[model samples]
Target: MKVAIIHDWLVSYGGAEKVLEEQLALFPQADIYTLLHKLGSQSPLIESKQIRTSGLQRLPIGDHRKLIALMPYAAEQFDLTSYDLVLSNTFAIVHGVISTPDQLHMAYVNRTMRYAWDTYHQDLAAFGVGGGIKRLAASLGYHYLRLWDLAAFQRPDLVLANSPFSAQRLQKYYHREAQILFAPVDTEQFAPAETRDDYYVTVGRLVPLKGIDLMVKAFTTSGRRLIVIGDGPQLDELRAMAGPNIEFTGKLSSPQVAEILSRARGYLAMAEEDFGIANVEALASGTPVIAWGQGGVRHTVQHGKNGWLFAKRSSESLNAAVEQFERLDWLSPQLIAQSAQQFSGAAYRASLRQQINSALQRREQEN
Candidate 1:
């Protein structure tokens, strides 16, 4: 069957891109379509695919978010008329792609676009649109974007969510129910170490929204060893704020990240996650997570069993969790690693196939 994979963009390798990569593994010959793509920013496997980008790819813009106005137009321009199956792997605009009645357009929606929805106020503040014309224009832009996003969100024949939290978001925003399919985790690649090191580990884009700054401040003040992995725009700022106890290892390969996760005493996460795949990976490495007690991390972390949770998005909260964390006995490495199998790549493929077949069968019966 002719297959097409639609993605939001390829500016960088992120959770959404990671899902797209897994999809590519399932359908190696599937043609890829995206709003924009920057070469060498993704894995070698994805870089080898036939990636078709929109007209916006020529803009030479560093941030993909800058093309927000042109996004829906670009998304609708994708010519997928010939494909039998169209899979939209998105956290952003790719769900806006047009589809035919005969074709199956399935979307793996992570969340509705933040700027158009949940983060609208935060985005307005970040852009410094205090009042008058700028705020009015920004508000109208997001308002229009919301209309387009909701219409785009409803285009897919079958909607699948990465986590229950994501499904809840879909219900809240689009008033649509979605089947929950946990994102694939590479459990096999990240195995438990024979022994753990004394340092704590945290991995993710070094962005402010990721709460890397919170982790940095907590460790800096306490003088506890922290190994910070991953790189992004906030790298320099984080580096500047980091104390002698903090170590930044900008962007490492999966194996290197796995090795670090496997040996670390615990993993630190401050961001509000959709599914918290990195935390799952830490569990696969037998490393307990000390994260903000919100979002999907609440689903994975069983307090006193695997790790501890903090109440707020502050350094004080993380330190409080850490204090309690030190008071408890160490969690079992073997059991923690074993618990992560539910999110393995193999299981993910099986569930995805089942959902596709069931959705197609239901569609046929309705016809």
Candidate 2:
């Protein structure tokens, strides 16, 4: 089949990009289409693809964030008429692409653009740019984006979700039901170590939604050590708020991240993630997680079994959970790693093939 993969942007490597990478692995012949492509910004495997970017790429501005307003237009402008199948890996606007009646368009939606819906104001405030005329412009832009986002859902033949949590969001926000497909976890790449380090670890973009501040606060009050890996907008702010026991490693190589996860006392996850891949990585390392009790972690983590889930999203709740975590028995690393193996790349490839076959069969029947 002549397949084309649509992604929102290729400016950075992230969870959605990771999913896109897996999709590329499944359909090596598929051409990649994105709103913007910053060369050398992602994995060499993705960089090796026949990547095609939209007009957004030509913008003189280095920041992709400023181009959000033009994304819907850019997304719709991608020409996919020649392709037999169009697979979209959407976190933002890529799902809005115009598809022909003859093509089967399948979407793997990680998030339904929470900024345009659930966390609209919070995002504005977090970015510290939503004031006066800027706020008014953002509000109007997101409003239009919302309208376009709703219409975009109608183009896809089938929609798949990265997690059950994402499926729920797809239903709630887009008014569309999506089949659940867990994101691929490189279980083989993250193996358990015989011994663990004394400190807790958390790996991800240091952003407001990640609740890094909450983790830092909780760990600070408890006087337990925390090692935070990764960098983002809130890095400096989080670093300022963190106490002596907390350490920031900025960003590290994949092997370094794996080694830290393998040796850490437990992985601390504070985000209401679509699917906490880092949690799976931790489990693969035979480490448990202390996660906020919401989103995809509810499915990945078995409370009091594989990991502990705080009842609330606050630091107090997380602190209490930490206190309780100190009293729990150490889980078997082999068993924890075994559980995470179910989300391995092999499983994703099989499930993706099944979904594709089913989608193709459905299209044939319709014709």
Candidate 3:
């Protein structure tokens, strides 16, 4: 089959891109289509693919990262009927691909669009597009994007959601039920260490939604040493505001991150994540997680067993959970590592192949 892998964008390496990489492995002959392609910065797996980008690629912008903000407008440019099978890894607008009776379209969604309508005002203000004509333009943009996003859901033959939280969102937003397949974890690369170092660690893009500020505040009040790895727009401001006990390591190589995770006393995750791969990485490295008991973290973490989950996202709640983590002596490193095995790469690959085969069989039956 001639598979066409559709992605929102290829500007940065993140969870959705990781999923796309895995999909490429499954369909080695597949061609990739995206709104923009920022080559060289991504995993070598993507760089090797036969990638096709939207008309946005013709723009004179030196940095492809800037094109993400323009994706709402770019969705109208994709033509999806040429391929036999269409597999979309959508976090944003690639699901807008139009399909025909002859082709099968499947979408792997990370989450529903968080900024299209519900957070439209916040996003507009963040971009300095406020009041008068800017407000009018933002309103038009939001309405157009929302309709496009909603209409896009109908084109897919099947939808696979990355988490239960995402599945719930799919039902609520689009009235579509989706198959839940948790994102893959590289368990082999994150093996448990015999001994752990004394610091707590947090790794992710340092953004507002990531709740890195909350983790920093909780770690400060708990009097525990903390190390933060990763960088984003908030990094400089956060680093300047952090206390003496907190250290910002910025971005590091995957091996460097694994070494840090393996030696850490515990992992601190504050986000209400859709599905946190880093949380599993921590468990695979034999480090327990102290996280907010919200969103997909509820599914990934077992409180006081593999990790401790705070009931609230507040610093006080997280600090209280830190104390609880200190008191708990029952979590064996072996058990923590074993808990992570369920989300291993091998398991993910097997499950995904089974799903693909089933999808193909169903299509054949329809014919």
Question: What TM-score fits each model?
Answer: 0.97, 0.96, 0.93
Ranking by TM-score: 1, 2, 3
- Give the alpha carbon lDDT tens digit for every residue of 42-154 in model 2: 98899988899999888899999888888888888888999998999988888889998888899988777888898888888878864799888888888998998999997
lDDT of 3 by residue, 193-240 (tens): 888889999999988888898888777777789999999889988877
Error of 1 at 201 (Å): 0.9
lDDT of 2 at 19: 78
Which ranges of candidate 2 are over 4 A from the true structure? 129-132
Candidate whose lDDT is highest:
1
Alpha carbon lDDT of residue 351, candidate 1? 91
Tell me the alpha-carbon RMSD of every candidate: 1.2, 1.4, 2.1
- The clash count for each model shown is 0, 0, 0
True lDDT of residue 196, candidate 3? 80
**Better candidate number, 1 or 2, judged by TM-score:** 1
